[model samples]
Target: MIGPAALTLLLGLWGVTREHSMWRDEAATWEAAHRALPELAHMLDRIDVVHGVYYLFMHGVFAVLGDSLIALRLPSVLAMAGAAAATAATARRLAGSRAGVAAGTAFALMPSTQHYAQEGRSYALVVAAVAVATLILVTLVDGRGKPGVPARRWAGYAAGMLAAALLNWFSLLALPAHAAAVFMAHRRGATRLLTRWPMAAAAVVAGALPLILASRSQAQQVAWIRPLTWSTALAPLLLLTVGLLCADLLKRLPATPPTPRALSAVSLGLPLLAFPLLALLLLSLIKPLYIDRYVLYTNLGLGLLIGAAASALVRSWRPLVTLALAAFAALLPLQLDLRTPQSRVDDVLAPAEVVARTSRPGDGVLFIPSLRRDTAEVSPGSFTALDDLALAQSPSASGTLQGKETAPQHIRRAMLGKHRILVVADVDGHPGSARDTVKRRVLVEHFTRCADTEVRGRRVQSYERGTSCTAPPLRS
Candidate 1:
């Protein structure tokens, strides 16, 4: 009953959470998905990505849904619900009905879980698969090493793990933790599992090969032109872990009697907290890819541990503690999502709408190279809202003018044919040499700013060709 109720609540929250705008990354995914199949393949090959499977998945998703916000985000919400249910079922089997219900509830209300659930990418799907795989692995390990642990069960778990790896490369980070848990569960059975490592590693390699080739061929695109500091990357990870800890506390409350509260709490919390940290330390020792979303697979352990603990605590203060912690976890995220949109990465509708409203039909679209520094290149039909317009590729270097040095002749030719042009550029600060002599000479000599407009919060400079503008900016 608690499990079903918790599932219901999580599903309800999904409806409300879906109401926000898309961030830059979601726009990128949509742009890639909406491309023609051949072009899409080319694009993926050219971009350094560990998750090419998402591009293929979104391609199918958009084919049916028509690229709307609801269309983009619905799959993620469903995936999250699946994850919540799986977590509950797994927790229930390992602990008890009380722990199972609490785990599901805790997961449903988690800010990070909720955050990704509303996205349009592969994280939610990966998390869902991870939960299912975790459940199967746990079942296999926790059950007495009876000869009856079906081969089909192991096969199913392997498939899920492979699929997860394909969906998001970060899912690989959880492998060591999962393997350690499995080995500990059936010490003797560990030898058999070890025998299967060759097969498992092969599947992972096969699944990841496409992404690897795509990355090598296309080169990874970095949105941040500047190097990122360790501090900036670490801050989000720390904050996310703290949020998960608080939610876990709520999940550990006791439901019915006959459960030893203190003993259960320690048993749950120590393993939940310890294993992930150990995993992180191990990863850091070799090479650290400390992204928050990458760590999401392990979140199941935390949710389960907390649920078990909360069930234990429920022996004393049942309703109040349960409700308070649940409320606290749910409220912060709800408010943050509502007031500050973009908490979920896949809400691309509002930003796309902004692009549509600001530009006009036949007006030339200009993308300033500096703006590209933010990992957001305008979507394929970014100009569709305004008009069926041709685009002028701007210089990607910071503070550089479009058509500076390399493309003076091209810009010169473009200006001769297209008189009405909008120069679009993101003005966010990036450290690079200022506008070079070529751009300065071209702007001063050939074109003059006619009207200025802004799209998606960037300043666009409209330029008209001067009758006396004869020589190309580069030649000048």
Candidate 2:
């Protein structure tokens, strides 16, 4: 049962492994990891991004794999696969083999997990690490085998907890919730272990210190999410926690057994499931830092809670048929949506591709107004930069008539030094400039607008200063 469930998951993941083209964030990861160590460090110092561990991990990944879309996302794929396997094991530990099978199978089909697995980001990897850590913690909490726990297992869990916290700061919250859940499950043993694991607790505090200090510095970068409102605050917490619970519960009913004990077990689990989600909801109201994927690590717990709930509902063949039809109808649209990810890469390809093909590997490719996280994601190996500029407002380059004020002089130095230049802007989306304003002002001077170039569903107007002008404007 375990082998087939894991195999089915691997096969399903293989299907979406290369579905979407490489988007911008994935590109940034490739660029960062592929560069010299010193160069990567210098860039990190400038940006307020606190993804140092991810940067370092990708540095090694890129060293071995080179920078291709498949290579960039391979780590995430492997991590999601690990999470699937771990979910199965964790379920078996918590419930029984039938429950474990259901949990693993449901995890493999989860749209959210599948979505992250296909991207080249740290979330999926973090999810896997969190799952392992959660499993270890749960084992300790549940007092599965130990009348008194082994020293080595305690040490191993201490190390794993610290590793999970460092991997993604948000999982720090998830880890504690796991400990709390374990305590609720086995109060006496968990209490004794907590007292014994003082050293482990100390290690966690020490490991989190860097993240604590870095949080102050990272304040400005994520300021966009602050000043929480009631609706915005509650929405993400509910979505991350309850949403997964509901999805998993619905997905697992087909395998449930109809018995009173099953119903009683589910009833017992509900409050245990809802508490931390409520805590997150309250915290979000105060801080407004909630994001749907931030609590992604909890999806493992959610899968189990859901599977347990479904297992409770199973009684007869009639209930099984009804549950299967309902689950299929509900998840089919979601599955289709995930199987076909919205390709921002397709949308923004016009200028990126044109620059990619035309520019030499060493040549500078500058974004007039600084690129978004997505646009900044283009491969550094493919297009070096003279200066990567983010304009304060768009429509005109700095110093242009349509622009707010003076463009930075440093930009002129970079532009003039480069042998040629390529300019790209979404006709409607470019800031400070209306569609016509961009065409009339910025596109005319440094770059001549190409006849046919469109990116990401928007018309991609391109201008070139030094190169031959054979390329046409990108079209839809």
Candidate 3:
């Protein structure tokens, strides 16, 4: 278990978290943590409610460790590793040692797991809390060979559940899955679960209500998550299938009926894997919240289910080796891709660096929608020579990812006064605002495009005052 958990952390630490540039949201995380606690709370009241707790946590991390990218993302790496260990522990309790190790390995190897393992955000912490809560639930139920849960253990379960819910309000969905597990484990009476689970479940829900309400009012933050299409709708099932296959394929699956313990694990794992996904899909029919990361905790359930199957199938070391080799063969490419700088929506540093290197001292930089200026936030002095044509207030003053924007007319006037400008924009520029259109209009109508280049999912270009604008001189 320790080995697998260590492997996960080491793999996440390998290259990318530090090397890849911060994206917009990550820039948000970085900026929020540098504020005074009261200021951070005020910012949370209006925006980024979903991430407030995470920001607070990162604030503490930054206070001590300072703000290197690795330091910023280290908490997530540790949380993911803890999630793997908890997954292993839960699987071990439900099945045995072989299943536990297999489960942990599967979790560490998941590309989604790897992706979030290095993020400086709430999702990995949410997964860790849920995994630990599930482990506690298993302990409370199984009691090794005893019949009932102790008060101390029940308290622990409540604490764990509360932590998970606070980390991400959507993790409250785990309540129903936990109820299903308890019912399956104690189906003969369910009196034990009925007596204990409700108090904890209610506590978690109650505690998360403030965050849920606050985040709800800011729903526009997720306006980008469109109504699900078929392929996106099928993703959870595909992930579940992949998890099971990863384990079961190296050795033959069991033909015999599962024992009561195995049945209990299956019940818990099934709901963990399915309920959140189903709930998200159903909810999206109303308000569209179907982003995949929201349900990332389901991967642990998949690992447990597959580990249980693998335990039943593998009686020897050869089969275990075969499973390990098979998993490596399949997940290597995903691991490689996860480590790439282009793994995110874009390399934010590209535009920052391009603008820094290309623009002249008096040049202006125009960020369509203005918020895109966060691309340069990662490096404070990187674009200081160039004026930000649309910035009204700095992020520090406004307590936001992008800060306040200048009016379109002011932006136009500012732009008209500059002879050279650097432009950084999203590739398609979807959801362009009226102001964004005006900014684009001013640039194209008055300036010559000296150069334009695509950086993964974003575009970086240079422009100059018309007529006098000629091909840029060559440099060695």
Candidate 4:
């Protein structure tokens, strides 16, 4: 357990700062965490209530650590380390000491696990909580028919589940997976587990109900998620294929001394790996909410199965060590790539750099679609020289991730009054609101593009007022 946790921590800390760049999502976290408590609460009341718990936790982290990028991300690194340890402990109890080490090591090395471990988001914390919950469930199942099992074990499971759910509501999907494990245990004459599991599960639901209700009104926050397609299945299918192959390899080996049916790696790991993912995929068919990060704890199951298979191989073949080394060699490029700023969708600092290099004092700035304001929010020093032409209220004052903007007519007047303006927008521009249409139309008709640069997924351009209006109007 210690070995895997230590390995995970080392991997997470290797490139924790990503060249001092933050993507838009991490920028969102930074913006929210830095806000005053009342402002953060107000922002949650209006948007991102889904992340309210995580943002609140980060608010406290920043309060103590002084809001550095490392402070923003270190909690996730530590959480993932805890997850690695918990995965090891759970595998050890069900399999053996060797299997525990193998499982924890496998989990620490997985690309998905490593990716979230370094992110400044709730997903890593959610994984840690769910991993701990699984460990507790395994303990309870193992202790069935024993005289000294305490109620606190169930309480611990409930608390873990509730924490996971509050961090991200989609974590509730783990309940069905847990249900499958408990059902399998009950079928093997552990009937009392059927009753006890429901009580714990009910507690989780009741505890999470308030967040669920609050987040329902913020549904549009995820409107950007497209409906599912065949491509969506490719990643999960690949992971499932590898896991099943591992399971098959274990099956081919001489069976170790019989364990409880429920404790078998196949029985527990298969359901844990498949159920939540399948449930989410199916749910996405109704409403497109299936993102792999939401169910990252499934990696725990995959790690357990792989570890068991690796343990069997080590016992049966001397070349197993060579194979492990070769596997790491093959994954080296991807591991390194995941540490770079380009690994993320967009680097908020890149555009901010462009703005800082090109703009002068009193130059106006515009964020097409408005949310690109995150770049400025993330690196305010770079933007301090320019005026935000459209902003009517600051993000904190407006209780928004992006500040509220002035009226469309007022925005157009503000733009026209400036001699030079810097525009920060998406590479493929969004169809924006009437206000955005006004900003675009005025820029295209009245301003000449003096310079333009694309960095990562964002575009930053400098515009100067032209002598004559000749360009066609921009589409909304």
Best of the candidates, lDDT: 4
lDDT of 2 by residue, 353-394 (tens): 555665543344444334432343453334454334323443
TM-score, cand. 4: 0.95
Report RMSD for candidate 2: 6.8
- Candidate 2 residues lying further than 4 Å off, grouped into runs, are 1-12, 15-20, 144-148, 186-191, 197-199, 226-280, 315-330, 339-350, 356-368, 372-421, 426-428, 432-452, 457-459, 463-475
Best candidate, TM-score: 4
lDDT, residue 87, model 2: 71
Writing each residue's lDDT as its tens digit, candidate 1 over 1-476 gives 34533553455355543455556566667666766776666555445256567878888988977777677777787787888888788777666777777777777766677677766778888988878877776666554435666777777777887888888765765666665554554453444554453466566667776665665553334333334356645654564475356445645543434542212222333344445555554465455434556666666766676666666666443683567466766586574654245344233344344445544566554344433322223343665433212224322221111223334455444444554455444445232433323333455467666555443344445555675323222210
User: Each candidate's TM vs. the true structure?
Assistant: 0.73, 0.74, 0.92, 0.95
Cα RMSD of all models vs. native, in order, equals 7.2, 6.8, 3.0, 3.2
lDDT of 3 by residue, 415-444 (tens): 999888888888886537777888888887
Full ranking by lDDT: 4, 3, 1, 2
Model 2 TM-score, all chains together: 0.74
Better of 3 and 4 by lDDT: 4
Residues 379-436 of candidate 4: C-alpha lDDT, one tens digit per residue = 8999998899999999999999889999999999999999889899999877388988
**lDDT score, candidate 4, position 104:** 89
- Kindly give the stretch of ten consecutive residues in candidate 3 with the minimal lDDT sum: 255-264
Ranking by TM-score: 4, 3, 2, 1
